[model samples]
Target chain A: MTETPSTGQPPEFPRPTAGPPEPTRPAAGPPETPRPTAGPSQPTRPTAGPPEPSGRSSARPSQPSPRSSGASPAPDSQSSPGPSGRSSARPSLFTPAPGAAPVGRMLLAQTLFEIRLLLRNGEQLLLTAAIPVVLLWLLTAAPVFDTGDYERVDFLVPGILALCVMSTAFTSLAIATAYERRYGALKRLAASPLPRWTLLLAKALTVLVVEALQVVLVGGLGLALGWRPSGSPLAVIVLLVAGTLAFAGLGLLMAGTLRAEATLAAANLVYLLLLVLGGVVIPLSGFPSGVRTVLELTPTGALADGLRSVLADGAGLPWGSVAVLAVWAVAGLAAAARWFRWD
Target chain B: MPPCDTRGMSTAPAVEITSLVKRYDAVTAVDGLSLRVAAGTLTAVLGPNGAGKTTTVEICEGFRRPDAGSVRVLGLDPWRDGAGLRPRVGVMLQEGAGFYPGARPVELLSHLARLHADPLDVPMLVARLGLESVARGRTPLRRLSGGERQRIAFAAALVGRPELVFLDEPTAGLDPQARRATWQLLDELRAAGVTVVLTTHLIDEAERLADQVVIIDAGRVLAEGTPQELTSGVSDDVIRFGGPPRLDVASLRAALPDGSSVKEVAPGSYEVAAVVDPRLLATLTSWCAANDILAEGLQVGHRSLEDVYLELIGAAAERTAP
Candidate 1:
């Protein structure tokens, strides 16, 4: 049996002008110009008949023959206006233009879908939200460690919040994205109409939603343990946002550059290491001077110290730590963008 | 060279590449390859493993950039005008491409549909691909069987109603029935004037479906033509018939026309290789009669498309081997 129908020529068939043919006018104009026009025409026609009539009147006087010519050949074109007078009169549908989904709509759908996937994966959820809540409870109840001058519950609350941000923004995000790259999901998306920036934004938005849930659960637990925040809520908000950006950027950098298995191991290792040494559970002041100075500069340490200052000390904002987080965000994101491979 | 006439047809080829060169450090993947596809036809790229077919297709899809070449898809540079060209192009990857393991097929398909401007109806598409049974169940993509996953991926590719489609090993994991269904869908796409470029290992699929078959090996094109064209002149026709064992080949050769030879490839089966014609057949029959022999089940045919493909690949392998 014939695999392909003989009714039409094959796509590889040579055209009349095969070599160095004249450059054709770009096809971009036809598809883009008519989409917005077609979108509004469908909705507007039912509301007001008078507007369509006026539109037809204007279209007829300006470009009547060209419209007919465009529609005549594309009998199967989905957006082509029909031969009937009423349909052709609309002018917008008669243009035979191909439709493209709006960029903003695509981004929104992608972000929602990403969030759903993150929530559905039991492992991802455990890493991003559940683990942090469990850790917050464990660290506060256990009294084997020294409390020093500050209230033990008060100091540990902010550090766990910082840990939550690191888990969602850095470790979980890095592992998931690396696996997506390995599975060819990122390659598939890259081949679609979804712009690169839209994909990045969608992932970022998904991380934010998950982190928001973590904050609520952890904060509620802190409240039950008699931990009261005396700092400005605005300062806490700024620290959370900045911390998320810094960790997410670093996560993407690892996901983009490393293999899936490598990213998995490295992300988990970094999470555990930072949990102990990055001033999350342990105060930076407890360490010796030289080591403390370096540890305080780490992103996790900066985020934890910054949050502790705002939530425990009622310090307005830790501008120095915020500035450090900002630099890491910029450097990590730039590196990820430069070296990331789609497939 | 004239300005594009108002016939409304875009002058740019659906896919065009010139002198494409891609290398991964020391090894070259695609070398000096050039191809042009018209706006409404199906072309199959056939090759053995590591033949660069995937690399070439990825370049057209804008997934991979060629180290040295100019490439365009639907008149736009696939790399530079990717945002503009992608909406009009659909790509079916080799495998499931790591779909969310827990997502139902319908959910993922609908989500993909929302990415396009005017996509095919998701429910209708699911039914068309015979995915209705699996789609209704809330099985995660990874839990589905191989055939089920392939069908879903196929549906995802066509859901956008793209102007051009690139399929990489689309039927690799499908069953016979699903393979037939996939072929029918490809036929429909061709009828709708959508351009298709596929890479496959099945020679019969390429022979039956492809309007043009491009055979590549060692990162280069070995031959390209219609099935009929490729197999036409490669080998002479063979006349085969059952006969008595151990027939004298020297005498038969002297009796037959020049450039003709007879061999008993198998006991009691004789094969005559030459430009088969009425005269040669008559001579062979008369010789059999004179020798008190009977030729049974006479048949004549030329080399098949498969033979040509194998011959070309074998020769190229030898030529390129260290």
Candidate 2:
């Protein structure tokens, strides 16, 4: 029996493109079979309508105008016919059909899906939510550490928030993207009808979504435990957004230039290093004077210091820290744009 | 005519590569290669590992920049206009290429749907790829079988109804059934007038699917022709004279005429690579009759694609061998 409807498109067959050599895209004509699009808000279903026929051998009787421009199926004796029994010509699925207009909306949709996938993963959920809680419990319960004049919760909460942003944007995002490049998902997407920016933006958006979830979970947990932010909630929101964007940029920068293994190693190594150097677990004042100066300018350090100041001392937003974080974000984003590889 | 006007279509070929050279450190991945993929045709690139098939495909996909050489996909430079060109080109990479764990087929396809103006139906795509059984499943992508994940990936690739597609060995690890299904899907795609460029080492896949085959070895083009054309020129009719007796190449060659040549094909047989006209067959039979040489298990047929591929690969290996 034939594989697809008897269309006049060229024969498209399977060829493994990236890794593991499992043939993914079959060379078939564009089977624009008018499927049903999923709902828009659920983040799980497709935006297009659902397709007709679930079985492999449904016979489509309508004979549209056959466009016989490309390579038709060869007259090979071994080539099987389509299910329709009409000349046994199966439509090639790999053939490119025309798409109308630009690819922005498509990109946005992809970004949201990335977010949904990240959210649903158990490991990701633990990293985003449980990790911050565990760190808070560990840091606060330890008797050896001194809290200076402020409450231990006040000093630690802001730092943990900053840490949450960094984990989601940089460490987690790096691993995910690196693996994607390794697996050929990125390469395949590069070949699809999606725009490049859409891919990047989708990734960024996914990070943002997870960050939003982290904020709600961590922030709510902090507030319930009698910890109060000294600064305006609005200012804290700004810090969270900026910090997320900065870390996301850096994450992508690492994912784009390095091999998946390298990205994973470097991302985790840099993340842990920043945690210690940037005063997430320990205050920067405890470090030597020379090292303190260097650490103060890092995005992670600046973010932690600025967040602690606002959340503990009721201080206004720190323009210096904001500028440093913004610069890092822009620089990392530019680098990713220039060098990212999908496969 | 203008730089791109021919028969109301672009005069410049849909894809144009000029002395494409790509290198990694000291290794020359692709060396001064050039090719043309006319719009609306299926072109297959055939090569073994490290033969620069991927490097060439990536250059066309706009994911990697070449060390040297210019590439144009759909009259637009891939490197300079990656975002602009991506919407028109569809790519299906090798299996396990990349997957977001915890993603279902619908979720992934819908996400890609937002990237295009005219995307196919998600359920329809799921059904077409035989992903309906798992459509409602919540398992992460890492849990899906290789074949199932590939189907999801395929759905994602076709979501936008792309104008051009790049398939890098699209069916390497599939079972016979999945491979057949994939082939059918590809046939459906070609009927819609999509231009496809695929790479594979499986000679049979290329032979069955490709209208034109571009054979590559050592980062260069070895030959380019229709599969039939490439196989038809093999001068020798491969004769596998199998019995209880073993033969050597020198003895077999000596047994034939002065112009005839023979080479060992397997342990018990030799292939006579010479023109086998009816007169020669008669003369051979007459000679065998005189010598009491029984030509049992004698078979004659045109060379298959595997023969051509093996010959090309063998020659390349010999040239590269120390």
Top model number, TM-score? 1
lDDT of 2 at A95: 31
Best candidate (score: lDDT): 1
Query: In model 2, which runs have C-alpha deviations exceeding 4 angstroms?
Result: A1-96, A100-104, A134-144, A265-278, A281-298, A323-342, B1-13, B67-70, B131-137, B145-155, B233-238, B244-259, B274-297, B315-322
> What is the per-residue lDDT of model 2 for residues B55-145, given as tens digits with 9 covering 90 to 100?
8998898878888889999989999887678777777766746555556657767766666676776776676666778777776676788
User: What would the per-residue lDDT of candidate 1 be over residues B1-322, giving only the tens digit for each residue?
Assistant: 0111233343667788888999989999999998887666678899999999999998888877789988988888887888888888888888656365567899889988899888888887776667889999978887899878888888877878887889998899788878877876665555455678999999877876676789988788889887767866676766777888898766666656567878887898887887554344545554554455667876555555676789899998788786
- The C-alpha TM-scores of every prediction are 0.79, 0.75
Kindly report the docking quality category of candidate 1. Answer: incorrect
For candidate 2 chain A, the 10 contiguous residues with the lowest summed lDDT are: A32-41
TM-score of chain A of each: 0.71, 0.70
Error of 1 at A54 (Å): 67
